[model samples]
Every structure is written in C-alpha cells, then in structure tokens.
Target: MPKNVLILHASPRLNGNSQTLAETFAAGAEAAGHWVSRISLAQAQISPCQACGYCRGHQHRCRLEDDMDKIYPAILGADCVALAAPLYFYDWPAQLKLAIDRLYAFGPEYSIRDKETVLLMTAADQNPQSFGGAEATYQLALVDYLRWRDRGRILVGGLNEAGAIEGHPALIDAYKLGYTI
Candidate 1:
C-alpha cells in the first residue's frame, strides 16, 4: 500500500544542497506511488513552543495559533516524515527545531509512535564529527523518545557552495531511500 510521506525542507536557501536531496527523494517516492507533500519551513510562520502547558488542559489544542495549525494536520495525516536540513554549527536550523519543539502541543498523545521517519542532511565539513551532533539528536529525540521507526538517512558532506550537491552521488542514495521507504 502507498504511504503518506511529508518532507520538511528545513534549509532557508532555495535550491540548496539539502533541499535538492529532499526533492530527489520526493521524486523517487512519487515514482513509487507514495503520496508526498513537501513543506518549506523557511516559508512557514511557526513560533517557538512556550512550554506553557496549554495543550494538556485544552485537549491538545495549542493556545498560540500560527502556521502550526496547518502543520498539525499535515503531521497527523502523514505515515512518514522526512526532515531535510543542512548542518549549521553542528545542528539543525532554527526553523526546523522550532517547529519540532512546538510538537509538544500534542503532549502524551503526540502522533509520533506510528510514523516512520527519514533524515537527509548536508554539510560543508568533510570531517565525520561534523554530523555527530545531528545524528545524536535525531536518534535521541525522534527515534528514541518519540519511537518513530527509522526509515533511512542520506548524509552528504563537503557541499558548501550553492548547487554543490547537484551531481553528488547522494542524490541517488536519497532517491533509493525514498523509493524503498
């Protein structure tokens, strides 16, 4: 059966390496008949979670309304969520992290356990340690805490300039990840 996959493009730069990888992944997923929706976090107006304990009393409805209103439904409807981001100072961009932090609105009933997840990342640094922080966070937060199934990840390094990842082999890897997910 086909799955509903949501691709969160967390890179602020348009057509950047990370976004390109995500688009390639989406293409393969589409070819394989899975429904894919790509959301650019840069364009979203999501606010940081205030840790205000509003959802607990309000039946999971967040008090501060913003673009998360749209994201909540998208997440609830997705069978898989793919996060594509570039390593900035060894971590995810603020846009993606903020959106994720807002997920606390769901509280204990968060739509996390059932969904499969993917991580696609790029970095200018070729050192393996460059990705350690991101990998650890992904494992600890999304995989361990939320219990989201690990689908696949494509981490490409040494791509700093614009369009640097255009001809990179990771594109094929990303496509394969999406196709096989």
Candidate 2:
C-alpha cells in the first residue's frame, strides 16, 4: 500500500551526513511507490512554539503564522513522519528541536498520535550512549506520550565532518528501512 511520508531533515549543514541519510530514505520510499515530502529546517523559516495556548481546542492549530503552518497541514495528512538529524550536544540541533516543539499544536486526536514515526540520528562521538538523549526523547514523547507507532531508529556515530558518512553502511540500512516502510 502506498502511503504519504513526511520527512523532516533537521541537520544544519546543507550536505551533512544526516541529510544524505534522509535523501537515501526518500529515494527508497519513492521507489516503493510512497510519496515523500521533506522539510529542511536549516533552510525553512520555522518559528519556536510560543506556548500561548493557541492550539488548545483550536483543532490542533497553532497561532503562530510561520512555515510550520504549511508543515502542519502536511503532517495532518501523512501516514508516516521521518525525522533525520545530527546530535548536537547529545540532543537535536537548535532548529530541529524548535520544529519538533512546535509540533505540539497537533491535537491529541488529530493525526500525529496515530501515524508511524521514524528517527535517524548521526553523531560525532562513537560512544554507544551517544544517542541516549535523542533516543530517550523519541521513546518518551513520540512513543509514550504521543502514542505514535514506532517504525524504527537509525543512529550513526563517528561522523562529524560533512560527507564523512558517504560510504557508511548505515546509509544502506536507512534506505532499507524506507523501502520496507
């Protein structure tokens, strides 16, 4: 069955490893007949959540008028949401974090809660715990709190420089993940 997949590329670098991974995933997804829409926070004009309670009883609509307004509509109609980013201080980059926090506008019953969510993180450190922060947040917020279905997560480490992950096997895994999704 073909599904709508919304991919959020939260890496700051224009051609970072995480971005590459996202492209690979999109390729596989498109090849499998699924529609893929991407939002690059680095280039997108997204604003942080104001927490003014505009979304409360507002049909999951945020009051802030920014790029997220467009993203919100796509998210509401997507079957899967894929997040790809690099670990900045063990957490997502500032832009990515902001975009995610802004997603709170999606009311509990609308769309996000039932869609499948995927994560891909790249880190400079090779420690096994490099992904702890992101993994914990993903598990807690997306899985536990939002009640979204878990597709899977791909964490690639030891690649700080742009293009360092050029030939990494994780890229292949990312593509396969999308292919199977």
Candidate 3:
C-alpha cells in the first residue's frame, strides 16, 4: 500500500549535504509509489514553543500560530516522518529542536503515535560519538515517547563542504531506506 511520508529537511544550506540525502530518499520513496512531502525548515517561519499549556486546555490546539500550524496537520496525516539535517554542536539544529518542542500540543487526547520515522544526519566530525546526542534524541523522544517505529537511519560523517555528500554511499542507503519503508 502507498504511504504518506513527510520529510522535514532542517539543513541551513539550501543545497546542503543533508538536503541531498533527503531529496534522494524522496525520489526512492516516490518510485516505490508512496506519497512524499518535504518541508525546508530554513525557509519556514516557525516560532519556539512558549510552554504556556494552552493546548492542554484548548483541545490540543496551539495558541500561537506559525509554520507549525501547517506542520502539525502534515504530521497528523503522515504514516512516516523523516528528519534530515546536519549535526550541529553534536546534536540536531536549534531550529529542528524548536520544531520538535512545539509538538507538545499533541498530548494525551490527540497525539502522534505509531508512525514510522527515519533519520538522515550528516556531520563534519568523523568521530562516531559526534552523532550520539542526536541519536539519543531520536530514540528517546520519537521512538520511546511518541512510540514511533524506526524505519532506518543514515548517519554520514566527515562531510564539511557543500555538496560533499553528493556521491556518497549514505545517499544510496537513504534511498533504500525510503523505498523499503
């Protein structure tokens, strides 16, 4: 069956390494007859969550309006969600982190649960430990807390320059992950 896959491309650079991976993944998923939607976080207008507890009282509707208003519906309708971003300070970018925090609106009543998720991360550091923080966030928040299933992850390191991951094998892995998901 065809599935709805939402990819959140959180790279600062428009044509950066991680965006390449995300586009390649989208290609493969489309080839496999799945519906794919992608959002560039750098081009989005998302605000940080205020933690005002408005959603809890307002029937899961966030009080502040921004790009998350669109993202929330996308997430609710998606069967799979993919996070593609470069590692920043050994973890996800602050923009992506803020977007994730805004998801607190979906709570005990309406929640994002049981969805399949994928991670495509790139880092300039070659050290495997560089991805530890991002991986931990993915595992704990998406998998454990939201109960989303892990589709796959492609962590590409040692990529510093723009378009560095163009000819990389991680792109192939990302494509396969999308197709197989």
Q: What lDDT does each candidate get? A: 0.91, 0.87, 0.91
Candidate 2 wrong stretches, greater than 4 Å: 108-111
Winner by lDDT between candidate 2 and candidate 1: 1
Tens digits of per-residue lDDT, candidate 2, 16-103, equal: 8999989999888999999999888888898888888789878777888889877887878889999999999888788778888987
Candidate 1 structure quality by residue, lDDT tens digits, 84-172 = 99999999889899998988887787655798999999999998788999999999989988889999878899999979998899899
RMSD of 2: 1.3
What's the TM-score of each model vs. the native? Answer: 0.97, 0.94, 0.97
Q: Give candidate 1's error at residue 130 in angstroms.
A: 0.6
Off by over 4 Å in 1: none
Compose the digit string of candidate 3's lDDT tens values, residues 91-177: 999879988998899986446896999999999999988999999999999998889999898999999998898789888888888
* lDDT measured at residue 88 in model 3 versus the true structure, 0 to 100: 95
Q: What order do candidates take by TM-score, descending?
A: 1, 3, 2
